[model samples]
Target: MTKPKISIVIPTYNRADLIAESLESILGQTFDSWECIIIDDNSNDNTIEIVTPFLKDKRFKFTTKPLGYAKGANASRNYGLELSQGKYIYWLDSDDIIHPLTFELCINEFSWNIIDFCRFQRTVFFDNFDVKCFDNYNIDENVFFIDKSHIEKIINNELPINTCSVIWKKKSLGFEKFSNELLYAEEWEYYSRLVSNGLKGININKVLIYARKHSCSQTHEFNCNNYIRVEAKKEAALLIVKNLAAKKMLTYSLKRYFICLSIGFKEYNLFEQIISTIQISSVEKIKWQIFYTILPLRLSLYKIKKAIKM
Candidate 1:
């Protein structure tokens, strides 16, 4: 059997209705050297039926799991990693569709040097396909390209990469778990580890991925009953820092030290100065600045008012 060049992992829960569109986009790829590995994540709905027709293709196969009930993308991705035979790995959300050229373009820029992951920007698709670029429309003079070192800086502390926006090298994708044993921040949790390992990537600025905003998407579509997800995002960040510092894998500076404190507060941890020493020192990243400085103040005011009413 001929080994496939790329393994596209699509994890589905109950996205039976939308999986068809994503599969169609994959089928339409200009590059024909790829295979699609779809993980059902044990959906109770008709997602299996939606995908069954596609399995007729020789390159397409399916796997099912019970742990991925909500079937977060990470879980499906890990399952795919275990099952993939291709040298390159691409993850597509069951509900989102890609531009026909995405895989082709990504493969062209592919590098396995741990120093590069192929990257392109995404245009969020709302009710229609309205495009928004990072530089907006001014392509000639306004652009930002960072090397592996610079890219690693952003992932060092905050989530700079959107999981669905790029295909990752499976070798560099080591992480603790899919759901982080918490709510939000699953992507950040994995991304931080990848960054710390000195993984590299390419940024193609062109809009290749289309993020679908609809009624059931996890990040925003699902109803946010409480702030559990956001709180999880906050705590996972602290966990990332704690794990890094404890292992001596990171270093921090004074300002970053303070910023870590602020994130700790945001995570509902102690706001004391004692937490300040927990910082792992590093040089400044072009001197960080807070754009919306009033956010914390405004949040405090609202929380105080809510407290009084309660």
Candidate 2:
């Protein structure tokens, strides 16, 4: 088989019902020089039976996560990255579907420009709804040149980039991999490291992917495991904060932003991790300590005020 120009790596769990749609979308791509690798994360459901038909196409390959490997999308994604044999990488989820022209449009942009990656817009579609009911999550910028300010904006949520909406130049990624330990915001943390390393890219300004929001999705599951989700965020924030500090791009607002992510969680040790990781004056440290101490009381007062107004 000839080496493909693009590789679509998808990590899936118990998505037997929806995995076929994602595979079909890939099969219908206008651009043909691509391979779709589906990495299964030990799904007990009939996910294998659903994906088997698609594997008849030479471009569609499927593999199961090896024993002893962690049971999450991060580990599966890392494995897919390892097995990929393409110049560009696009990570898709099992439950989502991409537009037929997704590959063609993004590939054209890469051919015309020198970039480490290309970012595109994605729409959020809920279950039991028409495809036309999707909502576009647009980024406010077009050209995302890697710089201190751009990186800060991403960390500050001013420029939100979705994982499925990106096509990454594999060589530009080097040895960077997702944090397998994190179950939430793993993409945010991984992308932060990539941007901080000075990878420049352009935004395509088109919605090429439809991200499914359903009860079974990992993001939705966070509602039940709130602590697990926040802990993951804290871990991801620590890595981002330390990376920014090392790059000398750490700012007061950025530090405050990450620190505040753990504010209401009441995890003192995790909060201290961020506080100690970033360089701050002793006086500022005292201020943080005071704020953390009174956080519960402050939250209670705010809740009371809100209740009274309501």
Candidate 3:
């Protein structure tokens, strides 16, 4: 009945199986002053069955609609915004969950500083933690102090702060709008906008969220992995050419170059993929542009790592 300080938004589709655990985690949170909003993208499953019990709490609600990720997530967020009396917003995917005390702790931590957003360090569960985070190209960064400058450095340096481990003020939505065109690169593009709007993010020294992975996910479905590493770099170069055409600032040019290089050298073994994608002069020209494409055949074994999908 009381107005809350935080609104937790979840968007799901056919997640009847895992939704309960996520809800249970929230219900068990030590923080009592919060509400949860679930936006069902017109699922045919018992997702409603899983959420039905929580309906009595004025804090819990749901919306059923036919929407995919880009539109679905944005619509759900806006829907939560309309229902929420909270000044702060937190988004959790239906397949992911919050720490038992996450809302309580993060809200308390918000008072420590005025921030546009906060990013969490993740602890993934890949058949449990015994295996290194590297098993799936997932990383768990150590607790460290990060402020606005650090975030700026991260943005410029090509490191990322993502939505899973991310929370931000509900008000910031008014300044910059979410994009509807992008399904995959939305995070990168959105973060770029948030930063461009002068909103700063900090890394909370806590493991606040868990990102789940399975064969059905985008990571597993990324059919371009064979060319992903190489294509990523080519994408960077193309992005740069576009940036120059658009006359955008070159502040991160070096960073972009390395990102392109990193993708080409470390992420893919795609000579044929390159020929198919790029029509830039001769093979020798491509080699001249690339620093290490000329490495010995035996060295091809070095760049075979893939990032964990969440």
Candidate 4:
């Protein structure tokens, strides 16, 4: 009968082996005024069996992906956002673990200042949480006050804002939702779009989420040579470019970065898409053409050098 202070939305598929641990992490949270919503993307595994026990607690709600709806994590997350009944929303993966104090720290930050979202660092681990591999810590600064300029950092891959790290104010999101067309880089595009629209946020400089770096994870499977993943990256880049273009904030360096990604991923269509979105000088066009033509030579030379060393 009452809305919670925060809602944790997790989109999952066939994570039966790890879903319970993720749920238990939520159950162990120090903050109590929160609800957890799990949207299953039509998984064939016994994921439901693992989740059923947690439903008795009343704070955890589980639902299957609506039939005929776009089938992906993006769609599931959108549905979770629609069903959420909290002031703040946290997007988390089904296989990741949030620190016990995540909600308490984020809620405290929200209370002190009016921000669209609160962000924290995340640690990556493999096999188990004890064997940590990486962290998204900014060595030069402990706290980061983010604004529109940070969107460029995201586009440049200078910042790592994963789906699990940021807790967003629901109303501040307005009509924005995840792009269902994207299977990869959806979080990057969504967060970049929000930042481009002038969302204010703060980075708390604490690793509050533990991201699992197993081979089954999407990030691990995302390869530049993978056709579907490459297409998703192109779509995401185009969408972000259009958003920045509308705001008259599209920078030359940002455009170059997108072009490089497109070329590096072997998705030539993105080059044409970028040209159609905005006007490019003749010199820039020629430069891109030359770079595209020389790619084979560059690869050959690199391989030759490696073979010589071997």
Error of 2 at 265 (Å): 2.1
Candidate 3 residues lying further than 4 Å off, grouped into runs, are 66-75, 127-148, 151-159, 223-249, 252-255, 258-310
Model 4 worst lDDT run, 10 consecutive residues: 131-140
Give lDDT tens digits, candidate 4, residues 14-97.
999998889998997889998999999989999999999999989999999889779899999999999999999999898898
- Rank all candidate structures by their TM-score, best first, as comma-separated numbers: 4, 2, 1, 3
Point out the worst 10-residue segment of candidate 2 by lDDT: 128-137
Clashes of each: 12, 0, 2, 0
For model 2, residues 1-310, the per-residue Cα lDDT tens digits are 8999999999998899888888887887889999999998889999999988887889999999899888899999999999999999999998888887788877877874568888877778887425453244343545444443588777877776668878899999999999999989898899988988988887776778889998876678676767777678768888898898998988777766765666755544678888888888999999888876787788899999999999
* Error in Å for residue 306 of model 1: 25
Q: For each candidate, what is the lDDT?
A: 0.64, 0.82, 0.59, 0.84
Candidate 1 C-alpha lDDT tens digits along 1-310: 5898888888788888788878888887888888899888677889888888898898889888555344466667777777888877787887777777787877876743533467667667775543232225332322344343553355554326666776776665655345525556666666555655566676676777778887666667214634666566556666666656655654445235445445435435433332443552333222332312454676789999999999
Model 1, position 82, has a per-residue lDDT of 77
lDDT score of residue 34 within candidate 1: 85
Worst 10 residues of 3 by lDDT: 126-135
lDDT of 3 by residue, 192-235 (tens): 55655556655666666776766544444444543443343344
C-alpha RMSD by candidate, in order: 7.1, 3.1, 7.7, 3.5
